[model samples]
Structures are given as C-alpha cells and as structure tokens.
Target chain A: ADLQQGRAKANACAVCHGQNGLASHPEAPNLAGQPIIYVTQQLKNYKTGRRTNEIMSVIAKPLSEQDIDDLALWYSSMQVEVKMAN
Target chain B: ADLQQGRAKANACAVCHGQNGLASHPEAPNLAGQPIIYVTQQLKNYKTGRRTNEIMSVIAKPLSEQDIDDLALWYSSMQVEVKMAN
Candidate 1:
C-alpha cells in the first residue's frame, strides 16, 4: 500500500468524500479511518457487482488489486477521534 | 421496528451517533438509513460479545429483543441524502 500514490490518485474521490475523508454529503459514506481490509473489500465489491452503485461502479471499475490496497491504506490511515456525547 | 418507540429511546445515542444517524464522531459508524436487520444484528453482536466497544457493551447489556428492534428502527429511519463528488 503506497500512501503517496493513493493520495495522488484520490482527487476524484474528494468531491463527495471530502478531502479529509468525512463526507460532506449525507448520502456518500464517510470513509476516513475504516479498516484497510473493509475499504478494500468494498471497492472490490463494487467492481465485482456484489455492491451496486451507479457512481461507485464506474469509480471502482479500473482499479487494480494494488490500486485498491493503496487507496484503502490512504483512507484508513486518516486520523479520526471520537468525542462521546453525554 | 417501531419508529415512535425507537425515537423515544434514542436520546442516549444522539450525542455520538447524531440525531440524524450520520455519526458526529468519525470513529462511530453512521447508522442512519442502515437496514433494520443490519442494525438489529449489530446491537445483538454487542450484547453477545461478538463485537466489543467500551460504551456499546454497556449500552447493549440491558436491552431486550423488543428494545433492540425499537432502537434499530429509530436509527435506520433517519433520512440521509448523498451528493456525488465529481
């Protein structure tokens, strides 16, 4: 997983997913800090038709195994802190 | 899945999970608009120790089957809209 390459390739995802990985939109999921394997599996699911989303299908179509790993690593490495509400 | 009952019981979750179900905390997964069964299963997982989280374990401990269903319904009913990043 090459984070440098992942960061470079992630511009396309910035719009819906937010540059910080916290999605500004309600519909697009916030992907920051997900497990590496979870993010990787999800992208693969989109590519394999296991998960169906018009936008995701197109975005995931061309990624190679390495591409997915790099992207997953980049997203999962984002720092996310939780502040519990009382 | 009783929305009314679920809504009434959800005050405890609103702080971290957000009243809208898009978690305010990045560490908390969004629960709004998730499938009812998925939410139900997750709560059950917490109760059964299949998944472990400090706060969630305490929260899920006393819930009955009906309580879980009601809470799951409440969170899943939250409306979430997505805007694609371009």
Candidate 2:
C-alpha cells in the first residue's frame, strides 16, 4: 500500500488516534511505532470478533484486508515519544 | 482502598502502562486521566471474559472489586500530555 494513501485513508482514525497516530484520547492506545504484526493482528481480531470493543468493532468491520495492511503500515511507520511529567 | 496501595499494586501494570499510566507499549492504552468509570468497566469486562485479551484477561482475573476500584481511581488521577511530532 502506498504510504501517502494510507495517511489519507487514516483521516477517520485521527479523531481518536491523532493525525500522527499518537492517540488523542487517554483510553485509546497510541498506534505510532507499534509492531506492524501486533496492529494487524488486533485489527483482524476486532473484525473477526475475537477481540470486541464497541467502537473498534464497528470501525474495523468494513475495512478490507488491504485497508488493514495500509493502516498497519502507516501507523507503524510514524514516530512517537513519551513525555513524562514530574 | 488507599491510593498508595493502588499505586503499589500497579507495579505490574507499569510494564505496559508506564508508572504514571501513560502506556509504554503501543498496544497498551494510556490510562492516565481516563474516565474512572471507563477504566473500571473495562477491567471488570476483562475479568469477566466479556472483553477477551490474552494479556489483560490474565492480569485482571485475580483482582478484587476493591483492587479494580483503586486501580481505576489511581489511573484516573494521573495526568498525561500528548506530544505530537512534526
């Protein structure tokens, strides 16, 4: 999948997982720099009902395998840093 | 439940969720400042098999209700910031 296409396709995901995949919500996991295998596996799990989250299930339900691959690749390619507060 | 006790019990969780509840692993959600209700509900779901996660289910299985409450409270009280990359 083209990285640019993946970035474009990830617009909806940016609502929760920031535009860069760093997670906008505390309840949402940061997807940037995640292992591609892990991200793909979870998406597949959500799609198959092996892992069920109300929102994730609905979001992943219609994603084609190619879409999943694109998303996984896009997210894994982004970078994130942990900023700790004192 | 004591907040201190919750912090102590959360040592195991810090492997994935940082000591302050910001996730260390991309697969883990940042728990800091999440709604207490959401955190508590998800833990219970994991414990009850309603949410099936290979790691979380096992970790949540033995927690008492009090433990869950403390964990929820502790995590909710923490603060985190989103750092975006350019």
Candidate 3:
C-alpha cells in the first residue's frame, strides 16, 4: 500500500494528533519523526492495553499488523510542521 | 530577564534537543510547545530523582525554581522547528 492508504487508516488519529500528526493536546506527544519501532510498539501497547488511553485503545484495536506498519512508515516519512515558536 | 537569558540557560539542552528544542533522537520528545507546567514538573522530577535521565538530572539539579520557570517559559514560548518529515 501507499502513504495514501496509510493516511486514510490514520484518520482516526487526527482528532488528538492534528491532521499532520502534530499533537494538539499538552499531554499527547507529537508522533512526527518517531522511530518506526517505537511507533509500532506504542500501537501494540494501545492494542494490548499495555498503554491505556481510552481513545488510543479504541483506535488501535481495529488495526492489523500490516496496517500498523504502513501507518508507522508513512508517519515516519512525513515531515513534521513547525508547531512551537522559538 | 528575556528569552535571551532563557536561551543562554538552555544551552545545555541543545545537545540532545536541538538549539530550537526539536529533539534529534528517536526516544527524546521535542520540548517545543509542551505545557509550561508540565515542563516545570519534569524539571522538578529530574532534580528530585523522580525522573531518571542522567543528563536531565545534571542539567536540572543546579536550577533554582526561578531558573526552571524561566527556562520552562522560554521553551514554551519558542516555536519548535520541523525535525521530522511530514
């Protein structure tokens, strides 16, 4: 699949993590540039309930492993926009 | 007294977190736009040994509460540059 597919699958994440994956909430972290391995692990955490965020768990539950890989790779490949001012 | 003072005090943070607060490492979260309260709390955590990163501890220990506040405000006020691909 392409990044488009990954982006589509990632739609559920846009609410908390902006459309481009920049985090909108103070507690939620921006997933931009996150290591693919770390991203996959966090998805696993959400899937397995090891990391407990109600919305994250709900979102992660439906994803197959392939979907997770695709999304992780897509997100990792995209550039994060400037979120904070220096 | 200004962002300049905060920036000077924040020089030590530049090694891991880039000069603009964008994290270079996969594991390190970019401190850009992080809530000032959270940033202060994390600094406090580092100082007190509640959060354990060797560098973070070294950097946090000597900071007085005012220093921490200044740094926190400075970092929070600054914009985080794009570090990852979108």
Candidate 4:
C-alpha cells in the first residue's frame, strides 16, 4: 500500500493496462479503481493457475505476495468514471 | 447453472457487456470466460453497497440472489482468448 513503491512496481503493468490502469489494449480489463480485494484475488488466481491467460499467467508467475499487493494498491488508487455504452 | 435462464436474463447486460460478455464498451470489463466465483462476488458487492458504480449499483439493486447466480453463469459460460498487448 505504499504509493511510491506501488507506482514503481506497476511499470510493467502499464505496458498493457495503461499508465493509469485504463487498459491500453482492448483485451485487457480496466483496473482503475477496482476493489482491492478483487484485483488482489485475480493476480493470486493467475499465480495459482486457477485462472490462466497466456500473458497474465506468465507475468503473475514471479510475483510475490507483497508484489501482488503493491500492484493491486497501485491500480486501486487510480480513479475511473464509467460512461454507459452508447 | 441453468444456461437458458441465464442467457435470457443477460439481455439487459448485452447492451453494454456484449452478447457473449465481451464488453461492447471500453469501460466495461470482458466477462466472457471469467470464473463464476469472481463474477458472482462482484455482483454481490454491487448489490450490498460494498462496491458502487453509477449504473451498476442501480442495476444490481433489484437482482435477487438467483438472478445474480444466473447472470454470472451466463457470462462464465462464454469463452475468451487473449492475444496480449503489442
């Protein structure tokens, strides 16, 4: 939950999830402002192979418990506003 | 879960989340192939005020527990393949 460390650790995530968790790619979920519990659980799922995505499974493989928490905190700290699909 | 009933109830979600839970909007997460536990928990969060979004909080307000399970099943039944960010 350290903002400074979280930001530093989130660089790799930004490559796909955007600089602020908005998702630069169509296939990636927008992580901005997602619940901390939700985000944390997902990474754990990938790490444990409960959920598998080609890239996520690989990316999540090396994350320690603290790394996962930091990433979740980084994303959760971002803000998002949902505009209904037109 | 009852697939037919789930599909029927998902009509409302289709306007934004797309027919098979591949969201039509960038702001909406792709639900296809997502784990049932994850989807169900999120809806419950929205319902209980543990999570809030302008549209989803209202949409979830009237959903019975059965309705939430059905909807989650419908989305989880769909498939997704990710190609990753370039």
- By DockQ, who's the top model here? 3
lDDT of 4 at A73: 79
lDDT by residue for model 2 (A1-86), tens: 66666777889899987776756776776566665677888899899988888799999999999899988888767654443323
CAPRI docking class of candidate 3: acceptable
For model 2 chain B, where is the 10-residue window of minimal lDDT? B77-86
Cα-based RMSD of the predictions, in order? 8.5, 3.7, 4.6, 10.4
Judging by TM-score, tell me the better candidate of 2 and 3. Answer: 2
Please give the distance, in angstroms, between residue A5's alpha carbon in candidate 4 and its true position after superposition: 15
CAPRI level of candidate 4 = incorrect
- Best model number under TM-score: 2
lDDT of 2 at A73: 80
* DockQ of structure 3: 0.31
Q: Compared to the true structure, candidate 2 yields what TM-score?
A: 0.69
Backbone clashes, each candidate = 3, 0, 11, 0
The digit string of per-residue lDDT tens for model 2 on B1-86 reads 56777777889899997776756786776666665677888899899999877799999999999999988878766654433323
Q: What's the alpha carbon RMSD for model 1?
A: 8.5
* DockQ of predicted candidate 2: 0.23
How well docked is model 4, in DockQ terms? Answer: 0.06
Where does candidate 3 chain B have its weakest 10-residue lDDT segment? B77-86
**lDDT for each of the candidates?**
0.73, 0.76, 0.70, 0.72
| Candidate 3 lDDT score at position B16 | 72
Q: CA shift at B70, candidate 1, in angstroms?
A: 7.7
Off by over 4 Å in 3: A35-68, A81-86, B35-68, B80-86
- Expressed as tens digits, the lDDT of each residue in A3-86 for candidate 3 is 677778777777776666667766566666555666887788789876556577798898998899888886676654444443
